[model samples]
Target: MQSGLALLLIGIQLVYAGKHSLQYFYTATSGLPNFPQFVSVGLVDEQPFTYYDSNIRRETPRQDWMAKSEGEDYWEQQTQTLTGTEQSFKNNINVAKERFNQTGGVHINQVMYGCSWDEETGDVDGFDEHGYDGEDFFSLDLKNLRYISTVPEAHITLVKVNNNKALLEQKKQYRTQECIEWLKKYLQYGKSTLERKVSPEVSLLQKSPSSPVTCHATGFYPKEVTISWQKNKQDHDEDVDLGELVVNEDGTFQKTSTLSVKPDDWKMNVYECVVEHKSRTIRSILTEDKIKTNYAPVPIGIIVGVVAVVLLLVIIAVAGYKVYQKNKGFNPVNASDDGSNSSAHSDPKA
Candidate 1:
């Protein structure tokens, strides 16, 4: 009988020693007690089982079972199995969460964080890890066993909590790369359509003698558009600086460009807007100003009336002067009875 009691004590000491060793190892490796999660006894199976206090990294001993008359080796084996099974179950749960989240399912929160499982015979016998929303579910299979879960929304918080942080960070970088690729693809998709576009309006900002004419041309599909100015048939060498390209929410690109050159180019030259993207090339140009002339009826009437009044006054004055000359018959040089004597005197009229 004393031998039996001694064996019981020895078994208890062995289990305790093993538990402490595991606790120390977990703390050292993971920096926390539970490697993954802390499952409860209530949710575990009724079979000869073990409950790992994942938070404390320890096990809850069944007092009645340890007091049994089973030999010390037998009891010791049970203890090892219980602890080992708990550790193994935790490891599996971690792996399952990792693989499931990788699938990009919306229910990753429940699938990864705060998950639950039953450990029996050193394996996860049963597990339930999600709550259902209207549309989605979560489940996993290992060998012949499966654990199923249903959840409504992707539980982001839970994902952040139980997620493998190192791997999660890597996934963020991967997502960024994917987004960049998507943008490049979108830009490439409509390259041909954009290149074939023409803007309706051409606006010249300023024109001066010394400065380059700054022209702003607006057009559709600006991603494939190129703006430039031309003088006499030659491409202008002035710098063309493009402004920030704004993309609208509706998948169109809007952009602006400033072309600088001597202001004399604006007088009679053609400024061209060039668009070249994928499969097409299009251009719009504005050339020299077209002159216009207009004559009004009222201005013509006023000019004619002024000319007639000036001519009538001049005719009356000339007639009066001729009559005065005829009446003044006295010789302008001297007075004489006959015009013959006027040889010495000139006669105005005789």
Candidate 2:
């Protein structure tokens, strides 16, 4: 429910007023403690654009940038739309801030947004997340940005789980009603945004000089891509680490898969990284250019050396204790010749 709603919301939200493809996005984040700031620079279809913030601020585009606009005068008119939204949601953030009375915490807030289309499905999808101090206050579905579920509220986590009086139902109805038309409009407008895209650029990254080789792919669109390592054209799933799709600074995505190559196996350069996606299928060979060879050897040598040293010391200490007992004319067990134990008071010289 959470993931689906998020996907639907953002896919529909940005395409409002018939905006097409997402060229890219610019984001502002807070780094300092207790900093109160969030903003986004959304470039849509290269014409109808969104330059807005949580403080109810937005920008009006000049007439020359039509590749970014959809209908007539959309950018100038977006100010009122965006400002109204900011005003509506700003109160919630303020309330959350006020309730966070503890001082030791950093008191941070962040807003993230994304617009992406699935290549094979030709379906537009989006995601938005707003949080305070790393805890999610709410998540917005791009297709229905206004349809925030009360589930993610930090102050009232139980409001969603313990919902008995159908309060959650009421909220869902309100959100759905408010954004249904917008979702429809977004789907209709964004269907044509980059039906297909270029194949991802691929490479391999090593976590440590001696660890596994990570197969990395970047600059691909529609989000779905698969990466596999092969030797002699056969799958190499042993000790492989697969990563999820990671969005880049650009609208494209990146992903990785790590293949553990021991020192004995690392000499073979025939290892290939194969990436499959709707746009295209490509393979990158693990050559000296693709992989770095700073791999550190396993510490087995050091461990064996330490163990050998410890055992040698233990043996020498035992031998010295026996020698000292013999020199002092004392039996280590302190027993008599007839197999009876001697008393503690027995003289060592005797």
Candidate 3:
């Protein structure tokens, strides 16, 4: 009995130690602590390159024209090499695309062009001029930019989970230390193979709450997300409320929403958290209702205005034909007279 008890104690202690270790890891891997958001430039075949960040915005030393030119040339060479490496990437992407066609996830065909350079500020005005029309590469609010290394090359992407409520529900089963481990693994493995150079670190962390809750959401490619709630088997009659989502450190998004309901509603009905993205939806249902409260209907004035504009257009189109006919000398008496006048005059002469 004593031996069995001892083994159990050892197991418990090991689990405890593991929890703390993750906490320490989570704190350290979060990025260079207090590293003022700043730009870092490296040569990609001698092209002028600039990385924009809060730190760079505050203070980036002015560089001379000759030095900048040399840097740009280096950047250009590196870029050419990277561009050449696209063969393998293209193969991978083609494979991925085939899979996507079968089960659509993300498409690489959307990538028209991408580059990296050395100068503090080099504009391939030409590159910006074409393609990448609706896409935003840099994370303005997070102060994070895509960076690849000189060695194996790098590509990192973050895909938002459609099942946020389920994720949050799973989170509740975790303790503080377990949560730390989860964050670390999520940051480490979730990244693409191309971006292996980046250290396993996350600078900022945000998470969603349980049940009909609200949180920010974002993703790398163009994505649309919807927040909604339902009661019992029927969808909720109340309006679902939402807030703007922001980009996370790993390039995914975080969004929030709120659900307010009476305490009695808990056992009375079920509440669900629904998140829809890219034609897929993930949702979680909980006993408690937490969707946003007291939402107002869409403004009546806007609806009225839209209806009025449609009506006015219809009236104008219908009235235009009458005005056109009048301008064209349309007369019933003239039409009859023109057709029969010649016949009548000829018969009278005969």
Candidate 4:
């Protein structure tokens, strides 16, 4: 199963233009402390709309639009479906443990399935894959309607799924047809939020006079964006490092691109960072005065006060980090012999 960290990385990399997707990630874990045994998360356009976990034993809406648009009957049905899925994942974890000859220690089973649609080109693609302990186990090939095993240990699952022609047909139909229709409906319901575009707040930052200057953009909608550097009014790529696109707590996105240059070099050239998103283009010039930094000198008394504040904040941050470490990793659900029913389509409203 893909670890929680791997799943998060996948989410970060799914940015595309004029493309929308609906994905479901189900995880089951064993021998984890202070975490759910099973968990399921559903995302539309990379925004989480629904969440379910063994501790809750019920599915809940993670977004306002989801709660307002879906009725009680819808949530109830979803909860029941996930309840079954939770059990299925539990059994799956046990099956995996046996397959690996593991009687104890941490283990994870994960399944990620989704469909993407490109509005401009009307192209549709679907994927369904499983992982164990952060390694690929098996995946569905929608084109050929077959299960591809990634390892010899997964051959048993591949054969079992392939032999069930009816289940294979259901999987294909769900991924290609039903999944697309549901994605459309979700897009319509959450249009105001999902389709809205927000420009980024751009800034140039540096830690010190000798450090690289970073052009940072934050609080932007629709993760598709570009950040480029220019030197002397020309495109520049040398000594530039692009950071990963990350999701903000408010559902917006942030990214950074760093440019390394000698302080004297930057003083002699016209350097700028260009950010493009939707129909907007923003530029931040690399100037000493424009760069925000914490290296400036201050009065000794003020510095002492700042040090005290920093020490307090560091203490709190360390405590929070300890708690975070305890809860880190994939959340899980119970498993069953038949995993077909756990598909996102199990929600009747879909």
TM-scores for all candidates: the values are: 0.26, 0.54, 0.27, 0.81
- Residue pairs in clash, model 1: 131-150, 131-151, 133-151, 133-152, 212-261
lDDT of 1 by residue, 151-265 (tens): 3222332343224344333223322333233223322443354234344233444333344433443334334455555556678656777654332222233444556654455
Candidate numbers, best lDDT first, in rank order: 4, 2, 1, 3
**CA lDDT, candidate 1, residue 259:** 61
Query: Across residues 1-350, which tens digit of lDDT does each residue of candidate 4 receive?
Result: 23322442243227487788887767777888877787777778878788777787787888899889888877776777666666656666777787778998987776677788999999888877666776666667889988776587776666655777776776677778778888998998899999889999888877778988888887889888999999888999999999866666566777889898999998998999999998499988888888887633432233345335322211110000011112112112212222342335431000
Instruction: For residue 293, give model 3's deviation from the true position in Å.
Output: 18
Candidate 4 error regions (>4 Å): 1-15, 295-343, 346-350
Measured over all alpha carbons after superposition, the RMSD of each candidate to the real structure, in angstroms, is 53.2, 28.5, 31.1, 9.1
- Stretches of candidate 1 exceeding 4 Å from the true structure: 1-165, 168-212, 248-250, 268-271, 277-280, 286-350
Cα lDDT listed for each candidate: 0.29, 0.42, 0.26, 0.67
Ranking by TM-score: 4, 2, 3, 1
Clashes of each: 5, 24, 45, 19
Reference-based lDDT, residue 236, model 2: 78
lDDT of 3 by residue, 280-302 (tens): 56566653233322222332233
* Model 1 steric clash total: 5
